[model samples]
Target: MPDEIYLPMYPGEDGLTATIRVNGHDFTGLTLELEVRARGSKNPVVLSTETGELSLDLPDGIIVHYGAELIEALPDGRQTTIDLFSVSGTARKKIGAGYITIGHAGHMLTASLSIVEVPGIQGPRGWAPLFAAVAYGDSVVMRVADWTGGGGDKPSVGQYLGPDGLVDDIAEATDFRGGVGLTPDISVLSTATLDAGQDADVVLDPDSTPEEPKLRFSIPRGEVGRTPDISILPTTTLAPGQPADVVLGPGSTPEEPKLAFFLPAGAQGLPGAPGEPLLLVVSDTVDTGLGGWWVTRDYHAAATCQYLRAEMLVGAATGVTLAVRKNGATVRSGIALGAGVTTITDLGLVLAKGDQVSLHREGGGTLAGPWVMMVQIDGRAP
Candidate 1:
């Protein structure tokens, strides 16, 4: 006997068979019976030689065969009862039993139905599916044993929905209106005086009427007037050796001041008096067409002469030869001449108040036209 047996079918089609054996020997020559109970049926369908679904062949085996009519009577799942029995004289004994699982022919490709020459008893059937009564749409329906009904009052205006999904109207809200009007009246309340150290400010006056407030402005005294410009005119000479005096002029104004300096020329000069005037004289021009010794007109001295400068001009001359004589004596001589004016100073020559002075000239080489000589003399009164 096998632990499980499978019978293959395609609902109403069949040609399946199985052989029976007992303890490895061919089962023979006894009253053989096969009982098959289809799924969900209360009674088993019995088969025997009397029903022609089981055949007996001595020396071979007893065969249980499935026919089209038998497969049509069974469903596509497990059977609740499948058992084979043998009878001797009047007592029946169970010989083979196992689970009979009936399924579609496609499921048999990966399954095995090892129907050995033996017999088997049937096994427990599988469980069935569960069902429940439920409904849906807008509201829910369920089986409630002891629940009663419910009721509530309707909602009014000025209401709001709450967290529990109920209309609430206990709390109310208020509305607001517009504002008041004002006029455009403004004026100065009072003036504020500030010290030099304080900063200038402008602020509203709180003590004035509420309907029209006033503004107060404060300013520090103007900075001290810019320093006046003071200027003194160039010092004036009053007298020699006297102290200088300052005199205010008529041009003084609030913005500028003008003062004149009356400085004394100072007490009369103490001792050194002025000397006699410097005397300069040019001898009359004499153009010498040739070289020669020339003489100038004699000059009488007005004051004693101590310093003397003598110069002469010659044209086309090689060198100079000139002289100054006082009272017919050569007091200064040996002065030279060149292309331009030639000057010489003589401090050694002295002339008295009535002495006479004269210039002597001697030309060398080619002396041309327009030759002249000049003399300057200065000294104190003797």
Candidate 2:
């Protein structure tokens, strides 16, 4: 074997034989020793028949074996070094050496060897194509291998793969135009009414057999209830001076019930005391020759008064004007008086509480002596 002998081989190849020839004669009775590794890797892998990586045909050749794991570990464009040695017990002798180049299968094939012709082998007779079919039950009866019409009635019967491979279905029929050999039936069996307040139930009849099943509905009857009796009665009375109100009382009787109302009355006021006769007096004596007016007397009414009237008495005067004012406002005026008494009846005035009344006198230019006037007002105050 040459030291520089280079043999190219691919990864993942099995049963590859390399003849171990020494001067045209087989190297017999020699135990195989082989070392394989990537070209530059320090760790080397050993191959032998004991390791199950290679097997030896004694005096013939060495067969190398590889798998997908070796193919992945050794890549294309990287080289593997292989060293072969013959071993007899502990003695080892170096034999042929070479490089195994891992590459694709056809990467190193020569043009002449690439297209080698292969001879054909004889085979059995071909099968004829299908000719006719017809619907029988769920499946169709088909006739095939009838290319030569030797016998007209004799036909092969079988099933075929539908477009999606389901049995007995045809590809050309999109809708169901044929029967499926069965029909379902449904009907109501019975209906029963139960008493009120029971649960409603619906059951399927004939539990042992599923075909032609019937439904049974159980319903409950509704009952009419009694009407409620109602009544409003005034039963309790409240004393006077209490807050006035109406309240609902407890019902009377059990079967024929009645509702009662208790009403309280408001307090009644006492009759007012007899109206008292009230008199408010205003009196003054004035002799103003300069013709000036004087408010003689004023009085505020301490209580409400009604039915008012005024009386005035003048001793003497050359000329004078007199008027009665309520709260400084004139309510009665133009009372002509020279002497004696002048009465103004039906004053038609009501004096509210805190009302002030005054007597005003204006003297004329010829006013003589002291003008003496006394006025009295009367009303009923309540």
Candidate 1 local lDDT, 346-378, one digit each (tens):
345554455556656554543343333434444
Q: By how many angstroms RMSD does model 1 differ from the true structure?
A: 47.4
Model 1, residue 354: C-alpha shift (Å): 99
**Each model's TM-score, in the order given?**
0.24, 0.23
lDDT of 2 at 65: 62
lDDT of 2 by residue, 24-108 (tens): 3353554666666665556776776666666655454455565554555455755566667666677866655555555566544
Q: How many clashing pairs per prediction, in order?
A: 17, 0
lDDT of each: 0.49, 0.47
**Model 2 stretches with alpha carbons more than 4 Å out:** 1-23, 105-382
In candidate 1, stretches whose alpha carbon ends up further than 4 angstroms from where it belongs are 1-23, 56-62, 107-382
